[model samples]
Target: MTKLVLAADHGGFELKEIIKKFLAELGGYAVKDIGAYSAESVDYPEYGHKAAAAVASGQAERGIIFCGTGIGISIAANKTAGIRAANCVSEYMAEMSRSHNDANILALGGRIVEPELAKKIVKIWLDTPFAGGRHERRVKQIG
Candidate 1:
């Protein structure tokens, strides 16, 4: 099973739950949810940090973080040295994030994107392989 770490603040709680079930239905994914758990108020940075740490520490293959606009949470996740977190608003962005940036973590906007579109972005980001070659050199420079 693919180990997936998930985290979200109150702004993203509902979308996170939806995606959790979506991943479950897709099968072959073992989701570890470190979350706000409900639609109550909470800080995005804490959850984002937790999810990014999980990926950086090798406890999870990849991570998904969510916030109202996907900006704040992704910023937080990127603060973790080894994590490359991408806040993607479209399928193209998602694909490029993985292929060009080799992002280990994906961030989504709960309020900015619809659930179905977000799902598509997630699938594309997960499916796309890193292009390597020049991209590998560039990604290394990011560290």
Candidate 2:
């Protein structure tokens, strides 16, 4: 099974819980959740860095992080070396991020995205394989 790490701030707590259940229903992944734990206020950067570190260290194949707009956490995740975190609001963006950028983390906006749409985006991001061709060169350039 693929190992996936998840992290989210207070703004994203509910969505994170929903995604966790969705992942469980999918039945092919082993998930590790590093959380804000509740809807209480917490800094997004802490969780983002934790998830990024897990993926960058090879403890997990990939990570998912969430914040209010998905921007702040993605920025935090990207601060970690070797972590390509993509903040995606659409399935197309998620597909392209994995296929082209080889994103190690998927960042979502709990406030901006609906639960069903988030599920679709996650499925697409996870299912898409990196199309390594000239894209490989581009991804290397990002390092």
Candidate 3:
């Protein structure tokens, strides 16, 4: 089973909860919410780091992060050595993040995209396989 880790700040906590349920019940993925569980103000970096590290250490296969703008949390996730985090607002970007970059973590803005779109992007991202071959070399160069 593929384990997915999710984390968010206060600004994105509600959306994170929605995504958590979507992933667990509808998507049928083993979901872990490493959270600011409620809508209380909190720092995203700490949770972002925990999500990224879980993936980097093989405790999880993928991660999702949320914040007001998705920028800070994405940046925080990318700081971890093995975490390739991408801030994706569309299904195309989500699909490409996996196909081209082999991104293990996806970042979404709570205030940016709607719930419907977020779920769609997640579906595409999770379904796509990394298009290795030449992409692998570039991904390695990025590392």
Candidate 4:
């Protein structure tokens, strides 16, 4: 089973809620919504770290992070060892993030993407598998 870990800051908290509901009921994956339970104006780094830790420790198979601009949270998640998190704004990039990099986490910009688009992106991301041939060596070197 694919275990997905999710977290967000105040800026993406609302979107995260919509995502959580969708994943639990319709996505056909195991989801763990870490926090930022409310849009109460908080820092993204803390939540990013928690989500990253889950992925890094193998507690979760993948992670989804949300922030005002996705850039910041993506940066934070990538800081943890063994995390190959990518911020994807398009369906192509979402697919590539998994196929080429074997990305363990996906980062989304709450203010930048719509709910339907986000859901679609998540589905695409989860469905793709790493190409894992010569790219395997490169991905291992990434961390």
| Models sorted by lDDT, best on top | 2, 1, 4, 3
lDDT, model 2, position 81: 95
Q: TM-score rank, highest first?
A: 2, 1, 3, 4
Q: What is the TM-score of each candidate against the true structure?
A: 0.98, 0.99, 0.97, 0.96
Q: List the residue pairs that clash in candidate 4.
A: none
lDDT of 1 by residue, 14-127 (tens): 889989988988888899999889999999999999999999999999999999999999999999989999999999999999999999999998999899999999999889
Off by over 4 Å in 1: none
What is each predicted model's overall lDDT from 0 to 1?
A: 0.94, 0.96, 0.91, 0.91
Clashes per candidate, residues 3 or more apart or on different chains: 0, 0, 0, 0
- Better-scoring candidate (TM-score), 2 or 3: 2
| Per-residue lDDT of 98 in model 3 | 99
Off-target runs (Cα >4 Å) in candidate 2 are none
Residue-level lDDT tens digits of model 3 in 39-117: 8889989988999999999889899999987889999999999789999999999999999999999999998889999
Q: Which ranges of candidate 4 are over 4 A from the true structure?
A: none
Q: Pick out the ten consecutive residues of candidate 1 with the lowest summed lDDT.
A: 10-19
lDDT per residue as tens, model 4, 33-60? 8899998999999989999999999899
Clash pairs, candidate 2, are none
- Residue 141 in candidate 2, Cα distance off native in Å: 0.4
